[model samples]
Target chain A: MTDDEVIHMEHVWTRFGENLVHRDISLSLGRGQILGVVGASGCGKTVLMREMIGLQTPTQGQVWLLGESLAEADARRKQQLRNRCGVLFQGGALFSALSVFDNIAFPLRELKTLDEELIARLVCMKLAMVGLGETDALLMPAELSGGMVKRAALARALIMEPEVLFLDEPTSGLDPVLGEEFVGLLGQLHRELGFTVVMVTHDLDTLSDLCTCVAVLAGQQLVSYGTLDDAIACAHPFARDFFHGKRAQRILGRSD
Target chain B: MLASQSSAETSALPPLSPPEFAVEDGTAVVHGHWNLRGLIAASPDLRERLCRAARRPDLEWDLRGVNVLDSAGAFVLWQAWGERLPERISLRHEQQSAFRRWQTGGIPAVRDGRRPPVPIRRRIIAAIAGLGSHLLAVLALLGQLILDLAHLARHPADIPWREISATIHETGGRALGITALVGFLIGVVVSYLSSLQLKTFGAQVYIVNILGMSIIRELGPLLAAILVAGRSGSSMTARIGVMRVTQELDALAAMGISQSLRLILPKVVALVVALPLLVVWTDVVALAGGAVSAHLELEIGYHQFFQKLPAAVPVANFAIGLGKAAVFGLFVALIACHYGLRIEPNTESLGNETTNSVVVSITLVILIDAVFAILFRGVGIR
Candidate 1:
């Protein structure tokens, strides 16, 4: 069942100053699965993503992205892996100076040596994939709505049609409706594009609806990670409460 | 609907009106006014239809009288604008500010908290930045000398005499008046002090020796360098530091450029090369004033003062003084570059570093002067 492990971290340890934020963590992400990491604020979700993206080095462990250890990879190989893995930072960290088109085109430009005509075509196509079209391309980051910014960030992440997509709190500030829609979009992209998705969020609604497998970070380890029904069936007080909170919405089908 | 509310009662709340929208001369005029709670409860159809009309191929939003909008309301208007409006489009009423709470693409009432962090890497960079300045100055001077030698070796005729004359006029002749004024005041102070102390010993003739030796060996170079550092070094730091904070340094890095080569190298080279010449100019003027002061106050004639001066100050004094000035110039440039590149991206950091740079540079200059004094005395050059 090993479908070409896209990301593998064996006994990873990350320490900031004197505090060990992530310790002896081993995680493997397969090619076409959605992995959801659920944790409260400051639970080292972003730190984990940083290690995956090769922005931070682990204290003492190994990390492999696309079959190559990130530490041992040459500059060209590292860049190639980075291009292959797209990251959507929390707060939709779109470069404010660039137009929406250029924001999506940033990775494309950085990676591919394409002419302007080809770049424009690719940028438009990516925007359209995120339910944004050619009309939304020329607007700057400051000119897009929150929903649009999220969409643009998504488009930017998918511009290279990356093998893996990492989204950090993609639905933090959004309302229930928009948040649900954003999750739905993530689901659609995953199904259609078949890119491995690893999302870090704390929304219970997202966990129940969108996630195929859920992992909870508590007590300094993944306390629970399984299919929603399987995890709910576990006889733990915290797990029971978490499942009940999610069940209240689906059975009642009420906004309240 | 509320639990007790009947169909008629719920309907009586008020049937929603049609969405009103208009576009004229690149300006979008969306006309809708709903109270806070009403829009929150209203259907999305009217909002969506209105947005579709406003979302013109070539138009901007003019949300002048928007009464209230939730996330849904904001999204509708945003969609209508076809998302092409520049940030200049704004809502006129105060109530609209409330609507912008969760919106994007326009001026939000609360500020966006998306500014990139001022990288701590810059502070870590300051140690190397000092050495960078010195190395750059030496490199620039070597480069210029090499180019001059190359020209002379290749085709000496290309070195125009007119250009050399112009350079002298700008560097020496144009600078003479200010240099004389500064040097003369220093000379008067030295002469006046020597006269005060020497009247006890009846050795006022030695006042000429004191003025000549001190001005040539130390005071002239130190004073000139301090003045220039105050005038130019502070300015260079402020300019570079401001640029650094404004993301100009980041821009340069992104462009794959060496900010030190582009910014630090030139200023360091100019100051180090110019300091010795300014010292020599200051020495000449200070001596002129010393002769005038001796003649008027000490009863030693100008001719007598000049006659004794050559014997009092050896060639070693001039050499030691110029050498000290060169070192001081290097110190000023290094400190300025260090502080400039160390600037964090905020006005507070800019102001603090600017003040710190000036104070630090001057203190280092004085400390360096003490070191020079010790070294020169040890070498028997003083």
Candidate 2:
């Protein structure tokens, strides 16, 4: 894989006992592209994302993230690679024991080099970037509302200035207004930082607004992987139904 | 500058250069990768350099050669420049946005230094207040349980049989192996020790009396109570604590289900029914162990030992042991549920409450055993 390809999967096959999730899937995500993975329920969108991040290994084939083979990297090398990327889990997944300020500072503190003052300043900047104020920093994750949780988690993700970010259902639980605001924030950050994003999302609004490219997963294979119009024009029945549905039509139609 | 090149060129980029500054011709020339990684690698010396440069008011700043300045790098530069942009700094067009962010989003206030240690007088007063609140809460929980029992009495159909059965299996049925092992070992140890003492006094036969009274009346009930308190009490509290964390308890309340009846009552009933039986089971195994030990040590046959046990230790002692076991079970379950219900919706609180439940229940068990000993002092002994 070339250096510009931030993530590359080669002939990956995932199986659980007798069940097959992914079969001979190959894809490459270039740097600075927001690629959204979409599929019907139980079609392994999450499992595919997991494989990309090296959380789960495929039964066959190799996955390379940031030009290093995930299967070949040792523990320390894996940790270094992990430090270069950030993941926002479906649930906010903030450490419950830590307050918002500490959660954002966690990655910085792990470096063991940044002074507390610099770490604090960076955390505040990130919180403000994500539209949270300084006063909200002391609140624990459990006390945060759903929208604030997402914003706080986003702040934590971006604290390290990661080269790439992986998001699982970034706007799943938010109301329409908040979801839109989150998408706007994400887009603004993307423009400013130019980091690659690989997100698994079911929301049509999120896919259309944030994703530069979409990969449609179906029938244990990548049926279509391209721009929105390309995905819609594919001959696969799942892709047709996905992009031509009434809701998809309304959203994509308005965007066009 | 090599760090900013696009990755399309297959040549690997040079390793990040640690941020540095050199005063040349009365201007501070800053260059290299000024991002988090480079800044961290050279943090101490770099910060010292920045601070020394900041002190030189006459020096014009040159930052046009700096590569990849992130928010962290910007914040460091901002702090060194007295929380504002330097008037004489040269910057690249793209580098201006990082500073623009700082201008729009004003500097955050630094946290004050460490808090003062609390005074002893205030600490004592706070402790007393905390104790008072805990006592009140425990009493309120007991009152609610009483009311729940009264309600269940009025409408027997509302009883949660499945929950009770589940608790029974979890707390009692699954605990058989460990309790049996411990009981038998303790029995052998106690019997052997007593036989040693009796042999010294030419009173080997009295081993039966000592083992019967102590195992049946005291050790059996206390052992079972302590074991169950550590095992089941913590688990009960953790289960309810997690339910509270996930808002499952609130969901049940919204569905019009009484938490006391459905959750607390089943545990209380299960422990009350289960503990006495466990005590009895422990007592029998202990006696068998004692019989074997006596046979080996004192040459007392198993038949003689069993035959003499009932005659030596009266029936009232057995009754008192069972009664204590029942009371210990009730208190253990109640205390566990009380702490469980008190947990806040956070993992820290869940962990703290579960630990507190186990500790407090075990302490309560010992305290209640003392009270039982005092109240039933004259009845259970000869």
Q: Rate the local accuracy (lDDT) of all candidates.
A: 0.68, 0.88
Q: Which one is best on DockQ?
A: 2
With a 3 Å backbone cut-off (N, CA, C), the pairs that clash in candidate 1 are A142-B105, A143-B105, B55-B80
Off by over 4 Å in 1: A1-3, A233-241, A246-256, B1-382
Using Cα atoms with residue i matched to residue i, what is each candidate's TM-score against the true structure?
0.43, 0.92
Interface RMSD of each candidate, angstroms, one decimal:
20.8, 5.5
Q: Which digits, one per residue and each the tens of the lDDT, describe model 1 over residues B144-262?
A: 54565465568766444453444334434555667779899889878877887888899998887788778988799888777766766677778888887577888988998556545
RMSD of 2: 3.6
DockQ for every model comes to 0.01, 0.35
- In model 2, which runs have C-alpha deviations exceeding 4 angstroms? A254-256, B1-14, B110-157
Weakest ten-residue segment in model 1 chain B by summed lDDT? B105-114
